[model samples]
Target: MIAEALITLSKPKVKISPFMKVSNSSNFQVSEFILKGLPGIYSWQHWLSPPLALLYLSSLGANLLILLTIQQEPSLHQPMYQFLGILSIVDMGLATTIVPKILAIFWFDAKAISLPECFSQIFAIHYFLAMESGIFLCMAFDRYVAICHPLHYPTIVTDSSVFKATVFMVLRNGLGVMPVPVLAAQRDYCSSNEIEHCLCSNLGVTSLACDDRRVNKICQLVIAWTLLGGDLCLIILSYALIIKSVLRMNSTKAATKALSTCSSHLILILFFYTSIVVLSVTHQAGRKFPLIPVLFNLLHNVIPPALNPIVYALRTKELRLGSLKLLRVHKEYR
Candidate 1:
């Protein structure tokens, strides 16, 4: 009823996006106008959101538990745990940014996101995404410290250093996305903001500009390549050094122990980076599997955070036992 009411009451207002410089651009006239909410994407979201919401929420819960557990138990307050907590926060922020909005469309067919909202989503998602990649790089460095500089690790990765690194990432990524939305505002609107995807994705939104999107496109290209490329290079280098160190270990048992710790990190790295590479290479290249790539992007964007707890934290004996202990203490008191 609310959806129907909102849809009926809300008359779509027409305005030119600032970046769109097309002459005579107005509602419904531009070749590729960014539309405010259309019902088409919403129709599909109805059937698709429940399962996705479950998975995202589950992951959110797990990550929150992990963060809290690490904070309460002093033993877990090392650099590694702090970095893991930062990652959990970023993952939670990243998933919440995209999924719930889509779910709302499914529940209520009011598919109209204002231009401001669209820009907001773009800004938030990209910022967190950059931060997520940066965080992974930090994780790689953490692993490198444990393996390569075991003697000096305590000094190198102190809690103060971890705090600074987390702050810098959040600030840097948040600032890094400024050009996207700021440039998007210049586009002139022609009233066709009907994005095919259920999300207010970056490229999809950018393509709506009636004016030359060269500025925004360059920003996207620069940020994508810089962050993605930098992360990949660092990860590879870290692994190479790690392998070298592990090889030099005197005892097989010690080396095996080191490798075991690495196994989970490697799995996550593969999942996150490979998905990114595949998505970037295939994006709008008119590849045969556009929908498939979207689904994979969805996975890359959300599933890592959802599966992260299970993949890295929940599987750990210490975290698991600590969580159970906390739960039992809470239940007994209740």
Candidate 2:
């Protein structure tokens, strides 16, 4: 009996089933991701490279010029132009975050991104995007104060206030987006390591995981709606109040001035939100034509960066003159 008991103990109380599935995801986890770079347009990725590269170049040049102009012309250092300066930085960062990788994918077919690099890219992309969203909200508030309460604008949006707001924006957005990558990192990506997008977005990568990603998906959605949605709501509210104030002005010139002050910003805002909305819609409803959404997503990131500075320069007289002065100085130098 003693021998049998010892043998039974040695044999194990229950036989282990070799056929049973054991989730050793760490062993089978994907080490790298193959960025597919726009489904159904595989043959034409080459053609898309030049335009995208040009867009990135334009964004970089325009934003750099804006930064230089703002720095050189001390008079351009008000809350409005200061906000534009911040926006330019955000736009440049956004373009820089994705465009290089996109060009590599399009031109060289260098689509495989390792897990760590992929996550890092995700962090940067999300961080800048969130920062841009918050900056726009700040810009809207600046406009609101300028147009609605011009008398108190200086007091409310002083250099000190702008500095504090910028600091808060940086910290809030940076901290808010940190969790997105962490949640993505926690997911087991053993199903397939192919990302359907040009970049390693939180949604695109998390969708490739084999495990239950409900939490990841839900967290991403929550973060998006909370940050972007909240900013958008406040922007709309600020504009609404501005419009109300503008309408109350009896002078046509005053009304026109107020509306004109908002026109450039509204254009950029429209471009930003329209692209996002169309991209989201294409994802849900235009699945049959995948290229449309993919291109929209790329455009959404690249075009705003390129066009924002141009729009602002064209609309704002000070910026236009500053650009001209810089051009003259360059001509004189050369």
Candidate 3:
């Protein structure tokens, strides 16, 4: 349903490398293929805003509830909950960065973002991605402590350790994700810039190139696997240790309860990573399967942030009760 003028601009005769060739007709010799422009993808973003706004509102409310409950309930103010607080803060950033923009696209017919706005989106998304990955790594270590050293959980995961871990996570993600923006800025875009999906993703940015993109693609692949993959392996190791520790326990009920406590965490991590991996590898190494990567990114990165709290908090008893207590307290004061 594209206009003929836009279609004409969509394909320029350039000499793109074979890897970049999605569909090469004898007539269309693109040096570098221009991906679709950014105008239409978010054109109806205003319509998309309401649902995303609701999601952010809900996540914000739930996180606030969790944060307040953790502060008020003496029993909940442990190192684990402290990390949960940190997670909430990071999740807030993650949601804040994306949801409002998405909402803007939905609520208004105009969906154009300036270059700076686009860059900001890229930075925020990568920053949050790094934070989320770093936090999960921290969370794994937290679980390792709780399960493996029940007697020494308090002494081990102390305030200082937790604080240091938080700082480290932020710094690591910041430094680690810093390269992407620098690399992305080097690429040139002419007419084609519209990404098929919402959000400013590296893949989307790289696709708009009319120059060599192999360097970007390789950097992306390396960073993606290195960060996310490392986190996943560490988590797996932590759980392996956790399972060993759980089996060592004499009481079956207690063991079951402990595992159950982490079930939500386990499930959420699986969903997050699985989507991430699929999204990473699915980008059209070939031109024909273009929409697959788009769908993958949209589903995994966008959808899971909203679903995270639902899986983590709503179903977990401590979080559920904590929410109730906060709500009840607010009702009483009113």
Top TM-score hit = 2
TM-score of each: 0.86, 0.90, 0.81
How do the residues 1-334 of candidate 2 rate in per-residue lDDT, one tens digit apiece? 9999888789634332231223574445466789989878788877988888888998899999998899899789888899899999999999998999989998889999877788888888878878888888988999999888999987999999989999999999889888888887777776588877898878778888777878977887788898988999999999999989988999999999889988999998887877777877876754587677667777777788899999999999989899889989999999
Best model number under lDDT = 2
Model 2 local distance difference test score: 0.84
Higher-lDDT candidate of 2 and 3: 2
Question: Measured by TM-score, how close is model 2 to the native structure?
Answer: 0.90
User: Lowest summed lDDT over 10 consecutive residues: which window, candidate 2?
Assistant: 13-22
lDDT of all predictions, in order shown?
0.76, 0.84, 0.71
Tell me how many clashing residue pairs each candidate has: 18, 0, 23
By TM-score, highest first, what's the ranking?
A: 2, 1, 3
**Winner by TM-score between candidate 2 and candidate 1:** 2
State the displacement of the C-alpha of residue 100, model 1, in Å, after optimal TM-score superposition. 1.3
- Sort the candidates on lDDT, descending order: 2, 1, 3
In candidate 3, what are the lDDT values of residues 25-112, reduced to their tens digit? 2343223222232233433434545665777788787677677888888888778778777877778888887767655555543356
Per residue, candidate 1 scores C-alpha lDDT tens digits across 159-230 of 788889888887877787777777776666555567756567777776765667787788888988887678
